[model samples]
Target: MMGVVLVAGALQHARVHAQAAGFPDFTTIVEKAEPAVVNIRTTAKVSARSGPQGQDPYEMFRHFFGPDFQPPGGRQGPQQNPRNNKPRAEPEERSVPRGVGSGFFISEDGYLLTNHHVVEGATDIFVTLTDSREFKAKVIGSDKRTDVALLKVEAKGMAFLPIGSAKLLKKGQWVMAIGSPFGLESTVTSGIVSALGRETGDYLPFIQTDVAVNPGNSGGPLLNLKGEVVGINAQIVSRSGGFMGISLAIPIEEAMSVVDQLRASGSVVRGRIGVQIGEVSKDVAQAIGLPKAEGALVGGVEPDAPADKAGVLPGDVITKFGDKPITRWSDLPRLVGETKPGTTSTLEVWRKGKPLTLKVTVAELKADKTAAVEPTPPKVVETVTTVLGMEIVPVKEDVQKKLRIKGGVQVTAVQAPASTAGVAEGDIILAVNDTDITSPTQFVKVVAGLDQARPVGLMVRTGEQTRWVAVRTEK
Candidate 1:
């Protein structure tokens, strides 16, 4: 009985140990990480807004950002200037404090990182250190697409945080943030890494955390327990413009890649392959004989583009670009954007239940080439075939020549599963599964052979866009 009591006590002690491990002590991390974080203040010359009776017009703005808030572009003029009693030439320009934000040093030689929006449109930038040292900062470069900007100050021997890879981060891991929320310098907030690789931006994936990041927290360092910088707090999801549990950080790895380019050319250039893509649906996957719903669905391919020159078609699914697997449609742009322009890369394309290898030369990302398809021919073929709960007719000869199509059936009416699959009246059906629909009689014959047990692939053309739609005739 004495032995049993001892064992019970041992189990109780082990439980207590496990519970204590769950709550981490952040004092050590705060002490080591706080020195590297800095408060950023900006000023700009802009037209000011004032009331008729010299009353303050931006009292609400001052309430949030303190009395130092300087509105970037205030109402220039309608009020007459006191000097001339007429609208002042080019409006009255006054230098006032623009905004307040936070940033952190990444090197001892005074290289720092912050959000592009933080320093955007600021005529002057000031960096303040924890030791009360202040210096004028120069904007090295800023990329609006990724929301990353690099700034440099004249200093050496500065305390900086070690950069860590955000790719190594996992959900539910302990993380901390040190920033000036509401201009409160060196404020510390702790939370877990809520998620990773969140697709909030087109070119960069964000690291979402539950850290209490607020207005002034933008461009601050998000540190791991090792006091390493994993991400830069850039945005928050809140209705009241305050912290509401969801904050987004730009991953340090991607930011460093941008920094490398910014340090070189003061700008960023990305590569592109001209293909408009969409997510592959489960029904479409099964209909196309794919094992699972993955890869990017090619909905439209621009004429004479890289993908078109590589034989990428509208219905083909791009499984891989070079050696990188396209886990989703968003991954393709990032991979392609990272590749050098004019460099040839291998492409793995899935078409009609078979895989094909092709090569494509990437081009510089420029203006979008995904223009809308030309208008359909108003005239419809006289011959009509009614089948599959809809009326089908051949495409007009003039329409075929204009659209450069060999043959397709125009959808005159749609009902039931045909409409259920997003097929509408006036849409054009170009194929049934793998067979191209050329004539009404051919379309009728192809519709008769459908398995009916599973979803069927329908190549549909809407407006100028063409894509594959999955339709199940049987319930």
Candidate 2:
């Protein structure tokens, strides 16, 4: 009976252990990450007018009661002095503004990281430590594009967290966040990584998680299970402008790169390929005769760009850059931004159903360069109504000159065939019925060759590039 009791006790102990393993004890992680997180407060001095020349109340009252203060023009009141009425030396009002944010310590020597938006235009910055000690902070550098800022405080022996590799993070991995939200200091939250390579349309790809991030959580650290910061809490997506279980954190790998660049040069210099790329959809894949839609499809190449100089053309699918696989379309930017300019990198692309390799010398990205413009629009001539249910006009020289194009057809009015095929008024038709058209005669002939009820492919140039649009001919 004693032996049976021992067996039962062992089973009970095992069950208890399993239950404990299911949940992580985040107390230690919070304790370690909290000290590095700080509250940033900024104050701006506003100009105020010196108090109104010390108004003499006794003299003003006596003046109002004087006999000369008799009712002015039958009005039962003293006539106001024009000098005193001249706005009473309007007190100058200047706004003294204040703001708050959060930051994490990156170095023991007092280097800290926060968002550039937090410190931009700030006149005075004060950092409050976890222990409630405050110190004035100085901005070391700030990168507006990445929104990363480096700050320094005059304190020694400060606790800092080591940066973790975001590349090693996987979906569903546990993470924690410590930040100041709504002026509350050292608030800790936990959640699992929900997704990766999330594009928030801000050009910075982020790691998506379900962490409970709030307004004041920006620039806080997202800690991994090992107590290292793997990401920087940056933004959240919600209709109500608050956390709705969706949060985005800048990957530490990218954030640290920006931080290092800021520390070195007070700004970041990103490498440029000078090509516009779009994701290869299933339809595009089928059109391009690709086995699968897996790579970034080049839609346009900037003139004189590194990609252009390397003979990278539209319709080429970029499969790899250097040693890294171009798994997603968004991955290219992060990789390119991290690479130094003037570096030679190998690019693998698929062109015309065959793999091609090219060596490209990355160029320094010019901030103010304008994107490439497409071919000019064709002029409108005799309007011809087509079975596509649209009125097409012949190319005129004036229209081409106005559009600054060498050749193409100008879309005047789009109806069934054109509108249904996604053609718009400003679109310049470059090809119709698979025949290149530079004039109205050629355009009409190409359309005449198309069979009714069959799909006709038309290449239309819009904005900066040309895209193929398929429209069904009228029966």
Query: All predictions: root-mean-square deviation over Cα?
Result: 7.5, 12.9
Per-residue lDDT of model 2, residues 1-475, tens digit only? 9999999999878777866889677777877778888998776543333223322212211221233322224343323455654442445543343446789999999999987777776778899998989999999899876778899999999999988988898999989888886568888999999998887656677889999987567788999989999888877776544468998888887778887777887878999898777676554454345567677777667778899899896557888999998877767766876789999998898765578999999988868345666544344456654535555665567656754456666676778866887887657776553346686567777777756445665666677765556676655
The models' CA-based lDDT, in order, is 0.81, 0.73
TM-score of each model, in listed order: 0.83, 0.75
lDDT of 1: 0.81
Compared with the true structure, what per-residue lDDT tens digits does model 1 show for residues 212-269?
8877788999998888999998877665534579988889988888898888888888
Q: In model 2, which regions exceed 4 Å deviation?
A: 1-21, 49-97, 314-317, 346-359, 368-379, 383-410, 413-421, 429-459, 467-475
Best by lDDT: 1
Candidate 1 wrong stretches, greater than 4 Å: 1-21, 48-86, 239-241, 368-390
Candidate 1 accuracy as TM-score: 0.83
